[model samples]
Target: MTETTIVQYLFKRLHQLGIRSVHGVPGDYNLVALDNLQEAGLEWVGNCNELNAGYAADGYARIKGISALITTFGVGELSALAAVAGSYSERVPVVHIVGVPSTISQKQGALLHHTLGNGDFSVFANMSRSISQVVVHLTDPTIAAREIDRVLRACYVSTHPVYIALPTDMALQKIPSKGLETPINLSMPPNDPSIEADVLDSITEIIYSANNAAILVDACAIRHRVIDEVHDLINKSQLPAFATPMSKGAIDETNIRFGGIYIGDVSRPDVKKAVESADLIISIGALKSDFNSGGFTYHTNTKHTIEFQVDHIKIGYATYPGIGMKSVLQKLLGSLDFHRIRHTESAKSKPPRLVNQEAENSGGQEITHSWFWPHVGNWLQEKDVIITETGTANFGILETRFPKDVTAISQVLWGSIGYSVGACQGAALALKETDRSRRVILFTGDGAFQMTGNEVSTMIRHGLKPIIVVINNDGYTIERMIHGEGAVYNDIQPWKHTKILEMFGAKEGEYMSYAVKTRKEVDELFQKGNEFSKAERIQLVELFMPRLDAPRALKITGKMSEKLNAKMEDTKYA
Candidate 1:
């Protein structure tokens, strides 16, 4: 039987899963395993810190289907917990590998530097169990290969993060390579034939009976890899389709039947009415978190809703378990009788117009969120990857329409403040490996940028050419809008934003930086014939905006958030 080292087998499996790079910071325990990465035909993305590594891994996984993150035991793993938890909350697949002390040392309970110094080795793994779908410690070499495959399979199947703890001694232990001859079973099990048929019949009946039916796509459609099926359903049935904020780019924006986003109370008047007034709504992969749903303000009745999830389908008050959306959507397309379904006029929604008259009239005025976002919608090209931070950028992006095949990355449900900067690094790297011509654009606020800003250096080191747009509003604008308008806590120390690239070690000619305070400057920078538009090298643009100005939808949601917080406080005291 052929044999390979334990760490080698693990890396080989990740490579098989299409992970070309591994993201993490190095430490003593994990140092030896890092050597195996290159041999296994994977690149090492050494992040500035473990947290950033975790966030980058999440971003890579979002684009590439699955990713690997490695960290040392205890401190390194703990630092990445927040990012991994965010992955779990949003259902991204990440394989988290932790290098631990030798089994002999663990058995003797030797005091370790990164440990709690209490001779207890299981504490960190215990903490990780809550956030991971599968947590495995590979102590027995004979079963190491099986355990690794098990956790990796779970990660891909469930579309959630999984954890693996590999002791230092286990890194070099001989393991049989025979199991790798067969690929891990990454396919989802088929639904029960009888149950699936019944569910499909019910869905088809409702579609035929309803006067007006609409399809509502959410993040899960993308997560579950069913975008094609969803599009087929919309096209064949001729039903108007709407997307939630998290699923903004899941469907082609130019589709005539594509309505604007529906975020409960925060949706545009026309969009809100169209979605809520529907007699039947086929909601696929809907994750209705507070912010995603406009502070839990979804007005659609449950009885009129049909929700298709990864593992089940819900129609009216009954749920059909053991049924996944991929097969169901495929079968639904075949069963639908197009002649019986009522098709409405194509949705009137279009990307917000590029030139706002009011802004155009005020020629030299500072850029406002209202004007900037819509203008961006017009400037974006097909196949661009846009990463938005969880502040004004996230809400602002909702107002913009994407070109075909553009992928939008954001953490609406998790809402981690500095996630985008690190995510941009990973995304740029992923795109570089797959499609170098495609651009990676990052829209981040100065406040959030400060948190993971160091990751920019990683981009510089790897020769990544991403356009970093810093929304320099002087402070946390989203927080100010929510509760603290003039409070010092919402303020941040200002930085000379144009000097960031130079400070991060970008040599002259390798990078360009601009500070645009007015609309004309923004236009001049992005217009045709400009170097910024070409994206041939790393560029940073400091976009100046009024500190208090925000997206219209953000203002509405912020007020609702404040009210919810106050109500919770009152409930606590009462």
Candidate 2:
């Protein structure tokens, strides 16, 4: 038997899961556990704090399939709770390991410095249960490995975060290493053929009879790790596919059958008709949250829609329980004849969305949002990682069309400001470790960047390379658009954005920085042969624009924001 401590076994489990780095802030309780990370051959990414650590892990998981985050008891775990909540809502799998007081101390009810001045140590663990899919505490050495396996396997199977409360003493306790011999079985329980066949036959019959069929995809396709199946279905069916805002980069956007992004009323007239008028709309991995669904304004009737979800299949009002989407789709794609349905090639195409001349032109010293986003769109390279902040940048990015293999990372549902900066550091490092050729590109507002600006130091410390574009509009333009147009609170003091690299620790000429005001400067930087086009080191470019300037999509979302915000509070039973 390979004898190993609980902490060592935990790290080995993470290694088995393909996690190369563990992100967190070392605490007194977790310090002993952190020692085992390196011993287990896993790198430690000490973040500025636990929250950023959690966000980094989330971003890393979005790219790397899974990630691990470590924190200490009460204070540390609570601080990272918000990030975990975001992971839960967005379905990103991150194993959160929180080091806790030793079992002996807890048994004796000893007060801890980070605790609530009380002897009860169960408060934080109880709170963590709300957001985690699985919660395990390694108080018993005998069951520690089994508990780890259970939690981690649930994490991968559900693709959700799990919490492990590791007491200091238990971390060092020896455990039988036999669990290390076999990999965790990530497979879901075998599907019942009777249930599976009925669901598959139902879906096949519907699609076979439908004349105008459409496919609507969303972010869960990416989360569930079925994006390849999605692409394969698209290729096999040759039917029109439309992505919600969260699904922008999920499919091959350049495909002829790909209609366009559909956001309720904001959708282009052609996309609106293509999706809304379809006789059958198969929405795979569909997330009907208000933002992705345009304030719940999807036009397709339930009778005409078939939804594929993680554990169930919903056709109209009927629910087939226990039939998983992964298997259902696989079976459906295999058995069904795709050409039985009609094609969308004959649908009349609408003219492309028009932009203001001033937005595209750089003749003036002032940079407008209209010109900025589309220009940025043209500059996006294939396979580049794009992280946009929650404000105007998120909405602005919708205007850009990504090339193939591009992975767009954003906290759209969470809409956390300053998330992109911290997430960018993690995503860039993830790409660097996995594929050095693909680059990480960030689009964040000045207000958002200012909140997590310290992340630059961490990025530099790790010797990572990411190109950060700071959209300087003088303040929180998104807030102003939705609520306070000219309010003083929406404004933020300006900082010299490009010089942040030097502030973080870059030697002279070690990296590139640019502060561009005119279109000419932007064009020159994005031109094919420019140094900014290639990132030999961390590149920071600050684009100066008017305070009131905002993307067209943001303008539309702003007007609807009030109505949507009101609807958010509507009771579920109402």
Candidate 3:
């Protein structure tokens, strides 16, 4: 009942912000906050570790646009930073709240758990400054409400990571009523006004003039929830549309306007030739990151180039589009004289090829990631979700066919390993709340799995039965490819695959594991997973295969590394 209790005040503010779940583990510094969470209508989502908790929060925010997490200082905060960095890079609005020692304790210079014997409360906060947009310490009740508003604005408006340090004493302090008040309107980015006409005119000119024009989009277009409009723009313009690796599901693959994924790293030579020869390029909601651009910049010599974003338009040739992609596309569609405009022969043309009735059919390739994904894609339910980690799964899924009804999500920016397991946990939880029959399927490598495999316990405890598929290729397959031969350092220690269920204390017959190698075994495991998903149990399937070929990007990187090695050898003893 004391007014100075910090946890009570903090919870009041969280409730005002409409945050229901605070994902993290309970620790000495944060116990008081955890105790007050239930009363504030906030559920404590306990994960196996802080890293998992951070990933879960990012997953939630991916769906909700904003979410929160709590972790203890130092080790917990440091572990959680990976996910925060991921959110920052990917533009997810995830708020990270870390618990620290009280002001009095810090003044006394007392040793703390997981600390580096330092008495600085800002140590953890400072470490996160590189990735987080804003890092603040909640030590003063007078400025508590203002700080909450500031951090919330930074997160919700910019859609980035924001960190708040909660000292033990501050969590117990009482807050003023104004600090807990909900606002009727929230701050958001507005479309650029002055440049709207210029953007439309420039794009119109390019479309009117080009022999072959194409729009290449990446993950941000999907993350910002504006892919639908971009799709409409491309379709209405009658222009060919291609997507980067992370932007696969932005439009239905079967759409006639849709072109196959463009992999600059391992591009099929034909695709690269098409992009290079194009006269006009419009990149909407796409980031020109190294992973997407094949390490070389594009549109350097293209006569017309433009980028449409939420806030402004950046044009490459002469004029910039300041209008939002959605608004500009909507206006263009409204004003489009479809009868007068004819798509160029080059843009409308397709190479001679056999058209298969079963476009989604898996290729007849045994022991390949691309071959396995299409079969799984065919089994997806309307509302089903796919969670993939970095490496083979990320790049492989780019070419894998997905049903129009299913949603796919993965970390596109930070590309952290071991993120899929925890993200699946959060996605499953979200699906449960929406009264959706959707299920979560996780694709992870064995090496990445070991990093945060303990997160399976969270699923058991929370009643989340996501189908976990562990690709057991022995070690870091991507690294081995990057370094070529004699890269034994990429291997991971073997695990007792089937014994994981017992180790996690899961119920017998409820938890199952399979070591799959042949095609027959792969089909059996899928059938088993489908059967177990209906029942109330966790299923982990271990897939065994040789160190197979990875995605095109990895193959390219590995080849580049081999060339560097050969060059070094030539210089040896000189």
Candidate 4:
């Protein structure tokens, strides 16, 4: 049998799990493990920094179910902690392998890179104390395979980040391969049968009673891969359906029964009114977070709320209303009053009107975020996937309508920037694996793009071509919104962004880039990128959206900032 190190065993387990890419920058402590990873038939996908790498792995996990990232101890561990915490909150399974001082070195007090003078290896415990499900230290080679399998299985099943500390010397320790076994199937945790029965009975009662009942859903349901079941439930029931912002694009918007994202306050007034006045509400896999439910927890008191949630899915302090979300929905399907018309029949709240209104404003040359997004939306096809950075795109793109069934992947609750590009890389990798023909689209602001832009090379090297559309507004637009008008520090030095694709070894047939200024140019390049005659790599399309105005949310936030700024100025003078 070929001798294998603990590092090799970890990589072998990862390979068995079908994880193709592992993100991180190499440092001396982890060099051995990196080499082991390479030998185990996996690519050590390097990133600009540990934080971005963690976000990339988190994104990959979001799309791929499970992923890993390697980093050295101390600085790298600390840098990646924030993203890992975010993943914990969202239930993304990210396996973090941190290189640490050898077991003996740690006990002997040998001076190590990134070690504090106090000589405590409690750093891992401290950093991940709040989030990770398990923090494993691989000390014994004899149980390495078993322990690794156990911890990896924990991460996958629980959908949380887990840390494995590899001692510097343990990289060379060998272990037998037979001990490792694939984890058992990780299905959703068993629901409380009594509660499940009550939910089903209640849903059956509600569906037969109310003429105007709509099913609402959220991200938790999507995480469990039950959206199709939800769609089927809705179809069988023939009930009108609505979605939360987190569940946007989960169901086809074009379906006559589908009502768009319901942000109770900011939602189309009519949609809100409909939800409020509806005789019954059936929510599937939904969480009643303040941001999602307009601060009024609808399902807080189960006795009063006619809702059901799939149980046992809690992310951090947030305990969602469980399988009530799924089971109740499915149960209601058989009880619908088929004669009732679909909700769209009376939807006074039509899609937002922009072209006519914006044209009247005469800021035709100025590219407001609101104005720019709708145009971009118009360009995308039905099955295209959008990977977005968490900046202006976060606020701007949310305003536009995505095509039915098109996937819009964003770190909405996490709000992590720089996730888009690397996520685009992962998504493109996923596209190739699934043998999908539709292009993976990436929308990122310049600043966020700079944060993880190096992944472009990773994309090219792997032949995973994604159409990267960069909104070159030059700085952190979101920061500017948060910090007010004087925040010039949020800006960055301008780069030849369009040419970087070439610099990254993109061949002529493989990729193309454009610097767009006018709306016409934006339209042209977007059209061309979709059908662009390129044979070598992915198309990198750069559009200089005029920074003439902010998105609606930003504008409101800016007004609030201005008021706060004025109050501060008055206080300073007083």
Model 1: per-residue Cα lDDT over 250-272, one tens digit each: 98887778888999999988888
The candidate 1 region of ten consecutive residues with least summed lDDT is 345-354
For candidate 4, write residues 404-511 as lDDT tens digits: 678877776776678777777767776666645766888899988887898888788778778787888868877776674446788787878888888988777777
Query: Residue pairs in steric clash, candidate 2?
Result: 359-371
Tell me model 1's lDDT, rounded to 2 decimals: 0.91
Runs with alpha carbons beyond 4 Å of true place in candidate 2: 346-365, 566-574
| Top-down TM-score ranking | 1, 2, 3, 4
Q: Which residue runs of candidate 3 sit more than 4 Å off their true CA positions? A: 1-19, 107-115, 178-181, 184-187, 297-302, 317-341, 348-366, 524-536, 561-574
Candidate 3 on 1-574: residue-level lDDT in tens?
Answer: 2243456656666666656777887778887778888887787789888889989888877656678888987878888888888888888888888888888887887886677787666677888998888988888887876787788778776678898888888876766654454662453445566567667776676667666777787777876667777767777776777777667677666567766667564554556666656677777777766556654434335346667666666666554433456677667777766555446645332321222224326545256654565556555555567888887777667656665656777875577989888888877776655545677778889888998889888877777777788888888887777573447678789987667866888887667776677667666655634675553466787877568557655677456656766777989956
lDDT of 2 by residue, 1-574 (tens): 6699999998999999989988888889899999888888899999988888888898899888899999988888998998898888889899999999988888888976998877888989999898999999999999999999999999988889999999988888999999898999988766789989988888998888888788888888888877888888989988778888888788776676777778887676777777888888888888877667776678888998899988888987798878788888888878988668677554323323334455555456567887777677677778989998988888877777777788889887888788888889889878878999888899999999888888888899898889999998889999998888889999888898877999889878777899888878887888864677877789999988888888877777777887677666675437
**lDDT of residue 455 for candidate 3:** 85
- Candidate 3: C-alpha RMSD to true structure equals 4.2
User: Stretches of candidate 1 above 4 Å error?
Assistant: 346-352, 355-364
Model 4 whole-model lDDT (C-alpha atoms): 0.70
State every prediction's TM-score relative to the real structure.
0.98, 0.96, 0.86, 0.85
Best by lDDT: 1
